[model samples]
Target: MRFLIDFFPIALFVLAYKMADIYTATAVLMAATIVQTGLIYARDRKLQTLHKVTLLLVLVFGALTLFLQDERFIKWKPTVLYASMAIALAAALWIWKKNFLQILLGSQLNLPAPVWARLTIAWIAYFLFMAGINAYVAAYYSTEDWVNFKLWGYVFPVVFIVGQGLYIARFIKDDDDAVEKKP
Candidate 1:
């Protein structure tokens, strides 16, 4: 369900592209994102920092794509999003002595701090790599190829993330003693 919510805008973008054009796809994506943002705000009764940032950039980039009629603007959106997240995680690791990813997901994870920190850094690096891949694909690929990448690349990472989550689950129980003894 959450995955569907996340993919909704991209699906709309593909549909709009097929039905009308890039501009139409951009517009449809913006509408879908706006609705998604609204739902997030309504459910939380306030905007999260990450959600606000993502919404702001998506709106800005979506409008730029519409205004300039340059498909590149829309294409760059994912790269920007991924890069920004990677940078944020890296900053948290270096500056705060806290693992932002663990903090964000800690309620459900019982991993030790050091393990969580390492996982956070790994995720940051992974995001950065994905951003680079997105840039390369968007810059060089044909429109159909880029769209296909968007549609298919998503599934691969999702599967990997889930697999990693399951792997981490095993470590969670193993770390329970360390977690409970923490000061």
Candidate 2:
């Protein structure tokens, strides 16, 4: 359910590209992203920073793609987004001595300060890697190849998320620990 809502735009974009062309796909992506963001806001009553960023980039890049009749803008959107995320996370962690990820998710998950710092660093690295990969593919590959990579490149995030969960699992206190501590 949640996954479908999150994936709605990308899925639609790929489908549109297959059925038509990059311009049509860009339009579909723009419309689908708007719809996806609306649904998220309706459910959560507010948008996450990520959701807002994604929406802005999609609209801006999609508009440029359509207006210029050039696909490079849409193709480079992911690289820009990922690189920006890496910079933001790194700045928050080192320059400001603040961990945005911990600030964002600390309430839901309790972990040591060190764990939070490490997680933040890991996220920064992941974002950089994603940015680099997207840039490489977009610059070096044909549009069709780049589009195929976009569809298949989803594996990276899925694996990274699962790996992150595994890394944090040991630090998270289970309900059983609380029950035992009560005695």
Candidate 3:
């Protein structure tokens, strides 16, 4: 349910691209994203930082793509988003001496400081890699190829998320285990 809410916009964009053209797809994506954000706000009564960033980028890039009659703006949107995330994560960890990921998820999963630091670094690297790959694909490929990559490239994030979950599983303490260990 939540997954569908999150991905329906992208799915609509892909379908629109296949059925019509890039401009049409961009319009569909813009509208779908606006709807998605509205739905999230309605349901949660608040928006997360990530959601706000995504909505802002989509609006800005989508407007540029439509106004300039150039597909490049839409193509570069993912790279910009990924780069921004990488920078934010890196800055939070290095300059601020904080792990934003830990701050967000710490309540759910109790891990040591070292583990959190490593996880944050891993995310930074992943975002950098994703940004680079998206830029390369958008620059070197045709619009059709880039569209195909955009739809299929979801695998990278899915794999990364699964791997991250598995890596952190060892550090996660069940309530029963924590209780059992209490003196």
Q: In model 3, what are the clashing residue pairs, if there are any?
A: none
Task: Show pairs that collide, candidate 2.
Answer: none
Candidate 1 per-residue C-alpha lDDT over 10-82 given as tens digits, one digit per residue, 9 for 90 to 100: 8888888878888898889888989988887777688767777778888899999989888898899889988
- For model 2, what is the error of residue 99's alpha carbon versus the real structure, in angstroms, after optimal superposition? 0.5
Superposing every Cα of model 2 onto the true structure, what RMSD results?
0.7
Question: Which ranking of candidates, highest lDDT first?
Answer: 2, 3, 1
What does the lDDT read for residue 80 in candidate 1? 96
Clashes of 1: 0
Off by over 4 Å in 1: 174-183
Per-residue accuracy of model 2 over 150-172 as CA lDDT, tens digit each: 88898999999999999999999
* Cα-based lDDT for every prediction: 0.83, 0.95, 0.94
Give TM-scores for every candidate, taking all chains together and pairing residue i with residue i. Answer: 0.87, 0.98, 0.96
C-alpha positional error of residue 138 in candidate 2 after TM-score superposition, expressed in Å: 0.3
Residue 171 Cα positional deviation in candidate 2, in Å, after optimal superposition: 0.7
Q: In TM-score terms, which candidate is top? A: 2
Query: Model 1 TM-score?
Result: 0.87
> What TM-score does structure 3 among the candidates reach?
0.96
